[model samples]
Target: MQTITLDALIPREDFNILSSTGSSSNTRNKQTLSIEDLKYDSFFFSALRKPIFQRETNEWDAEKVCSMIESFVNDELVPAIILWRNQGGYIFVIDGAHRLSSLGAWINDDYGDGPISISFYGNYISDEQRKAAEKTRQLVNQKIGSFKEIEAISRNRISTENDLKNDIAKNLGALAIQLQWVDGNAAKAEDSFLKINQSATKISEAELELIKNREHSYAIAARAIVRAGKGYKYWSAYSITEQEHIVELSKKIHQLMFGIGNINMDDINSLPIGGPLNSSLTLDVVTQTVRICNGLDRKTKTNVGDANEVITYLRNTLRILQYINSKEKFSLGVHPFVYFYSGIGKHKIGSYYGFLMFAKELIEKKKIDNFIQVRSRFESVIYQYNFLVQQIIRKDRQSKRAYVSIKDYYVLLMEIILENPTYSNEAIVEEIKKNDKFKYLQTEIVDNETVAVKSNFSRGKKQQIKMETFVESLPRCPICGGYICSNSVSVDHIQRKQDGGTNAVENGQITHLYCNTTYKN
Candidate 1:
């Protein structure tokens, strides 16, 4: 659906405000507010806060946001915003968060890249997010005049030839949005929020779990890693020492998984997690990674533990990521391009989890050396017949289903290759078919039938061509003979430095971290 983010337009506040003093006896507040009330400096605007449990206000696209603004400006029958005044006198939006946030975004000109978002996210915004913000800004400015321009025109401080804009400016002050209030305690308001939001857009199970258990260790750790410990501090309630520990560990893991910039068609040399960073998906991945690393079942709902548990989860997750692709001594430096990406350059989430499971097994069983001995040949087989990965993922689109099969596939493939390192691609395929579980996987055969060709290539085809070229040109690690990229590169001394290896170029060789540090010695 290509949603645009307006999450930062409204700040999130905890709904646990019943304990605070100065409770508002009145159930309802104001009935309506004019466009002026939405201005950044307006008192009414300053009091508006979204509940912490509310989903991010990013479901609307640029067109939808702009349309809402246009409808408001045209005085259409927009729905009333439902709100609750907490005991602390803070006005919480029980419903219509996106609606109010969209209006505030227009008035403040902060679709997401504005000062509010930068400050809220602690200036860790990604290029993808910035680009989306710029696009929303451009679209809004083009379709409807900017709020500033319209305001200036209303005050006769500027002139424009467009008659429609002048009319909008003239009527802007008189536009007032209807407001509805929710009565009762914090629990009631929260209930109302869940009911309204669930009935409307329908929250995903993952998101609902996160919202319900926002303070859980897994949720805290996931949020920390997803935003690289820069966005809203979900763990702020922890002690300073614990918070610092959480940030340090989360940042390290974040760098390990997403240190490489956003993946694009032009650059196929290396990838961190095999795809662009998506907020929801990345959050889910981080949550899953934490659970799996901690030996927690995927379907189990864990309790909201203390900060120590959260830190432990983060540390365990970090260890797994380092083992996957890092410069650590014990790291296998598993190449993402080989294991996580599909034959046609698509990032396979199933393959990613499969590798995680495989890596965890190797670490647990102390079979890293065994795998390393057959790694080069194993990768060659996987690369030669990468279509199997595509078929497995396509067959089982769900990650849980695909991950187990892919992990088993890796284990079986490695067993066959270790049994006979000299096996050809066809020989390996024949051997793999012996396992009834993988019998459905077959090598692709070309039709060779003449068909009409398009003058232009599809984006996927272009990306595939680029990926092929990039893979063909990649440098192999001298020690492990596996592909190496910027993320996993380490320089080794042919003559051990302890044995008096000099700084001369002849003494140096490029190798994977594990190869140089552990395997070679």
Candidate 2:
């Protein structure tokens, strides 16, 4: 197998290319330019006040970039580069930012990891994006060679040096292919972008919404936080101090979700921020969660309030999420089944967002402490009945129905925890079965075809053995006969030490403090 790294793909002519094309900020006054004209560094891509939406740069994978570069070099009939001139007279690319950036990356020898790309996106290009550029460069070199090599190859094709030079001049020099300049103000330019991109491939609905209302606070906060301030800073419109806070807050939120720690452990039962599934789901969830939490109807229909005000709410919201996963509080931190993962081996986007919706409810009601008090019991009930939750989630998966069903579980869980601070797993299960929506899950259990359901949560006895292997894994509380989590729990002698019980691991078990201290005492 072949491996590609960032350094392996660097062209020997990178410095020579940079040296040959000395700095010149000459604007492209002409509407048409050929592939050959792009070799120079003079054509500045400063068209719009912001050429590309901040969150969306280098989103194209290597194959797409490489294919685009090859298409341009082969002189294929490609789409026109849409241009719009700003008040500063800078020619900005309205629709072809990624296309132009791909070509520019080729000419400049800067595939995001390069110094030029570092400066381009303000040093926020992510590792995933940088690797993508590297892979693309490798593909481009394998297929079409570097820009200088392509120039040399074009020259080499002819036996006569003069003839080769003539070929380069005639074919490569003819930069005029196609260009469409949109004459308009910023709003008009944005509208053109939205209309043009509706037909373009690879633009998700979430991305389209963000592009359409890039100025909205939900959009701004989501973009800033999604990539951990490692992409274009959408919060650039805010004051410098506000921008700093946005970056800081975004970093914290990013860490909370994806940080390498206890929450993201190798153990399958670990608390989940996310898992390896849809790469784009993070941005979508964060952006939508912002709108959901802040009560924004839609990017177009709703006013997202002031940028600073949105940032303030987002920061607090993120902090609340962070608090739930904090190690110091109830060590349960986050329960994977409740928040991010279904009991089945699938990453549940519904579970993630549904839990956040629940968190938003908690924050709104100022019930963080109250929730914290019963978190152990809540986790216990859910853990013991993991198969039931998995059954509900697996039925819908990523559809709209999945979100509603999972949210129904969240609502019921919250209500039960609120009404009965110390509830039994059987009670919670009974409560869930009473709900009309969960009636189907109960029917599966009553039919005794739980083989499918059991396989999801435990894969049968193997999972039971795995669960038993973990030293910290405790059984249900003996006194209350409820599920137990590692929070406000007591280690008691199975047969009280006073009654001749030893403090051996086999002789000990975990129970809730109330059960051990009040009842067992």
Among the numbered candidates, top TM-score falls to 1
- Write model 1 residue lDDT over 329-434, tens digit each, in one string: 7777777887778657667777787788788888898888778877887888888887787788777776546777888889888788889888887898899988
Give the per-residue lDDT of model 2 (tens digit) for 1-521. Answer: 11111221111110111223322333545667656445434544322223445234435567777788767766777788886665545555566766666776787677667775565446555555565567777887777667766566565654334443344334665545588878756678667766776777556777777766766677778777666664455566678888888888877776666553223223644444644311545567677667655655443474555767767757765755654453433222454434455444356666666666677676677665555556567666665565665677677765545655766786777677678766676776677777787767752345465456534453744544554354145455665544444433567688987889997899987765545554455
Provide the TM-score for each candidate, comma-separated: 0.90, 0.66
| Model 2 error, position 181 (Å) | 2.6
Model 1, runs deviating above 4 Å: 1-3, 18-23, 299-301, 343-345, 394-400, 445-454, 495-502
TM-score of 2: 0.66
Off-target runs (Cα >4 Å) in candidate 2 are 1-29, 36-40, 46-55, 120-125, 151-176, 202-212, 230-233, 260-278, 295-307, 326-332, 335-338, 342-346, 363-405, 414-430, 440-521
Question: Where does candidate 2 have its weakest 10-residue lDDT segment?
Answer: 8-17
